[model samples]
Target chain A: MAEKIATREAYGETLRELGHRLDKIVVLDADLSTSTRTALFAEKFPLRFFNLGISEADMIGTAAGLAASGYIPFVSTFGVFATGRVYDQVRNSVAYTNLNVKIAASHTGLTVGEDGASHQTLEDIALMRVLPNMTVIVPADARQTACAVEAAVEHKGPVYLRLGRSKVPQVIPPGLPFEPGKAQILREGQDLAFVATGIMVGIALQAAEMLDQEGLQAAVINMHTIKPLDRELLAETARKTGAIVTAEEHSIIGGLGGAVAEALAEDYPVPLLRVGVKDVFGESGSPQALLDKFGLTADNLAAAGKRAFQKKKG
Target chain B: MPAISAATLEELRLKARQLRREIITMIYRAGSGHPGGALSVLDILVILYYKVMQIDPHNCRDPQRDRLVLSKGHACPALYAVLADRGFFPAHHLKTLRKLGSILQGHPDMRKTPGVEMSTGSLGQGLSAANGMALAARLEKARRRVYVILGDGEIQEGQIWEAALTAAHYRLDNVIAFLDYNGLQIDGWHRDVKSLAPIVEKWQSFGWHTLEVDGHDYASLLEAIRRAQMNKGAPTMIIAHTIKGKGVSFMENQINWHGRAPNEEEYTRALAELEN
Candidate 1:
């Protein structure tokens, strides 16, 4: 079994180190510093950290102001509150002006577990990606979360980085450079492609192994950046594999699945299957149970791959 | 605080009248805008740009300069007029208010307009941004002040109270906010619409130094600002009681003019009143 680390934990640790290197870095939290791991940065840089109580809208607006004043502000909260609650502020204040605000929202998707539908965020990527100047990133695991933090800060404009709660396997090895708006092929196969983001990347790799045993060669691609998506790589995957399965711990409507389908439909027509939560809210359940219920497990990805493969044949 | 000199006050009053005239003309040309709030807030903008704020249009991007966020951004005609008069840009650019590809947007866009500190059109967000500016100032150990203006109706937004709490919680003493208490929103009278009565007490409870003044009185406005500046450890809110469409005879205290552009005939009458 591979070592597992929650992306939120990695985000916290990354912020602690980045705080030392970046003098202009400021962290704001709507009273979720400890949960979002912004507490780590708050501890290191007391003056630079601002805990804005439970005011998510104010936190986002304040981050925009800080960005306007030549500060790199990383605002952290739960994904639901950060994106859904403060959509107007994110759209008008940050994205409209193209401010350097990094919205690092953690505990997204069904992995929020027993916190239930209210806490779970299955629509954040869709919301953030639609905004004009917003950069949307969903890192696959702990190692990738660090790269996301670096990329978000180094990138001059606004960035929305989606992070998760439950511990997931670290598929990307240590010391791998993270390139924004680029896709990486983890495993090479020709029959079909499993393109995934966030925690589902691990599941897609596992599903590829399962398919290989069934005499079906599958390719696994990690697409970390959802917006400014690597259309070139997606086009190549469509041309080579001829079928595509997109998996994410989000709704099938407008996440990795929606993005890949849209790209493939426009650029390279192919049989595409979206392996994710159907268009419905999640319910209270254990993390593993929720993944299984939502058809977000490796088995589900393999099934989705086979379905897409069969469609290609048809 | 010492009284503003007679000459300075008279100069500002004259400048306020000129700005009011400019506001009417710009709105008349734009074909659509919120003239009532712009006229209501003119005196305050005139005082801030001409006397109070430590800013220079030439050094608009200077780090140490004082910041002003026009929170009630629907009244951006007032702000655009003041910014143009202060030489932030060519004065002729004022004619292009709300035109496509023009810097003078219907709302204050910091990216487009020169000397506009933070892009703001949405109500209730400016105070949060002001709090951020103050926080950044404190972080840099820079002794710069941040000024924000809010509408009487805008404070009805839940985000305003959220930001008020943030300013008070963080003890942003460098942030001074003004409420354009003109007593009217688009729908009707503010009291009838949603009673923000005991408004001063509300700010007092929010851990701020609160005061009320005649919004059109430059002396009283300056005095209140002086007191706010002298205070420490918390933010301040100056609820300036103003009349909507203050300088125009027909438009004063009229809720109908809240978001209507002045027609050609009304423009002539308004300009005549301001000229007088």
Candidate 2:
């Protein structure tokens, strides 16, 4: 309904704008500045920005060094390289000591089309959230991405902010507040709820609308902050609705789906269903084709919601 | 060159020997710690920390202070001993190497210990981190120098080369690293484990100001650091040749001592050798 914008674009713009205000902020990229959109910041803050070519491990370690020296260093690369490829560097260098390093990763999820499984990073959320002292954030839209970046700057310690490559609809309203460990409940319902994250937030909204026509009310939640999860909001929504379904562009295991299930089991157990990649690697395809093939579409999410709703009554 | 009196050099040597004894005792008390690398790198750390680096134990976190990131962090018994002896912590804390709730972790944890600039253990990442510290110092124009100690076998991690290129590319003259060429690792000799032959050429090829020296020699280590500071354009990598378990008679060049603590008999023998 509105001009679509990629969250990575917002992250880049926010970084460049904030570069003028925050002198302590430094940026580093692993030879992916243009693709990751860190070039926007690099152009503005030439002295403060470092282009570490094609070396993710060194980039992470260098960023850790900068952070230890009292600078808030935001290093950018793809989600696959930022989390999985350099997991040990990120863990030992940044997370272990609780350094104030921001790992803002773009081109996340299966939406990294035509790149195949090698570039598609469906398990980065799982990889990052498992580590101690790592704050994982997945912004839903461009406006929210700006809020997430500013919030990440204020929040100290290690952060893993996931951004997207493809342009997506503006799901959240303009100027909505974004805070760490808080979920935005965009739509309300009773029978079942679709707990979604990242690009799937828009799909969940469409699913909720579809479920309402069938006389089955479904709630839509944008669970952006995966780590330090908003457990209170999740449990509250779960109690109101007897069933829950999770949606994401990531693997069903160890992503938002897994996180929601873990929290729900601990707080309020409900009949739940997870809709995402079924532990299979993504392949070369268009963004829309990949979403449709991996069962990440609204029709698929609506089908999952109906199943969860029926299972709750059963 | 700053003329070092024979007395100062001899005193540094004796202090290094005493710290070696403490390293052995601490590892034995902890029941598990690396001894070979610690013994190999102790003399270099002693010369650097005691003579070369500008660190005030009282203001360990001062922005303008010099720092040393032990990249070969398994040899931290050497670093911990140096830091404790330098009064960064109580001398009594040297008894706790890897004990529970102790400030000294198995690897370096900057948050837990004073004077430890960076948390390192997983190898190859320290030089890159040191490069960051150097870059930060340049940005602040604090004249702060960052030093790094890396193991010969540890350089096989690939991130070390990545960092080597980085320091040289950035012209980080404020950074100086010592490659502890002890020639021995856990598996065997560096030749068998991973031959880092032509290592000096490797660093020079990467645009670093490379040099070779006897790591245990106090005058040579200090001299190399001085030259590194004066280089003005590139980071320096001094390939310091050393012996594994330098002060210990039986453990010298022994691979088994690479990651293990000494037993009662070995500890007694090691202490006796150090007393000389």
Query: Residue-wise lDDT of candidate 2 within A1-314, one digit each (tens)?
Result: 99999999999999999999999999999999999899999898899999888899999999999998999999999899999999999999999989999999999999999898899999999999999999999999999999999999999999999999999999998766788899998999999999999999999999999988989889888999999999999999999999999998899999999999999999999999999899999999999999998889999999999899889999
Local error of candidate 1 at B98, Å?
A: 1.1
List where candidate 2 sits over 4 angstroms from the true fold: none
**Per-candidate count of clashing residue pairs (backbone under 3 Å):** 0, 0
- Fnat per candidate, as a fraction, reads 0.75, 0.83
TM-score (chain A only) of candidate 1: 0.99
The two-chain DockQ for each candidate, comma-separated, is 0.83, 0.89
What lDDT does candidate 2 reach at residue A42?
A: 89
Model 1 residue runs over 4 Å out of place are none
Query: Model 2, residue A251: what's the lDDT?
Result: 91
Name the fnat for model 2.
0.83
Expressed as tens digits, the lDDT of each residue in B46-144 for candidate 2 is: 988888888899989888889899999999999999999999999888877788889999999999999898988898899999999999998888898
RMSD of each: 1.0, 0.9
Provide chain B TM-scores across all predictions.
0.98, 0.98
